[model samples]
Target: MVFLSYLFVLPVTLLVAEVALLTGATTLAGVSAVITFGLGLITVPIAAVAQGYHRAPDALSPTTAVVWHLTSQLWDVGDRIALEQRRCRLRSCMQRSDQPFALPRRAVFVFTADPADAHVRGNVTRSRARYLYRLDISDTYGQVFQRGIAVAIAGNVHATVSARRTLTATDVPTP
Candidate 1:
């Protein structure tokens, strides 16, 4: 019975602890204390039942399952947000090329441009069948701005593109 408990219940408890640690749940300190102080009591009975023994173990089982459950939920949420951000970026890029595209409320006017540049012209040609170019402008923030010049070519294509900029303390003055 003791051997069965050690082999089955003991290992399962340890495995749960390992999973919890890997998923950023329980700390090593907590796992160590919980397992050291109570794991035996918790696994012993299950082991005894499997082996037809009448007695349970002396220690309590560590609450590793709870930690694993919570960590899994956190991981799921993080994954969802990441996916959403990617989708939003792609949508923004496409919207910038769409005709009659309006700037997002939070977006400020930076500048304007004609689709005569080689790069702009090419992008328009590639997307011409899909969109009617209305107006192309750059913002003060160096963000590419475009509006729908004609009817919807495909679905709704409205996007703005922004370039990376370095900011200095002089860019913003303290009030």
Candidate 2:
């Protein structure tokens, strides 16, 4: 229902904006029209989510590029990322330290790309996610982020406030 509404609303809204743009609509006026539709004002996202379709980060993947950019920005701002369902936080992201060998601590997850994981778990397919790196976490709740490897079945990527690193600018960089 929400998706169908988006299909109808997004294009119609875009069409209006384009028409307005063609007519030399001012920026404020364009914003007003888009706001009038009530999707809420969508500014440039400071961070983005790719909904894991894989179980770990693929360095060669275009998705990795997106993650690289997004994660870099997040690191700059010192933010933690949530892996949707599992809601695990990615801190001190280390790439390719070890292969993920077991189900992540929070298989409280849903697969979006592979229907198999979804079928087996009865979760809505969102996409694949993987551990991009291997980092040790204090894990007070004892939930590790897929053992620091990405896995399949994550969706709705967004930045979070969980377990961020406590490094200051003067801290010695890890070797």
On TM-score, the leading prediction is 2
lDDT of each: 0.30, 0.33
Instruction: List the candidate 2 regions with Cα displacement exceeding 4 Å.
Output: 27-29, 36-175
Residue range 5-93, candidate 1, lDDT tens digits: 45775666677777777777788636654774475654444443443211111111122101000001122212211112222323223
Off by over 4 Å in 1: 27-37, 40-175
Model 1 TM-score, 2 decimals = 0.19
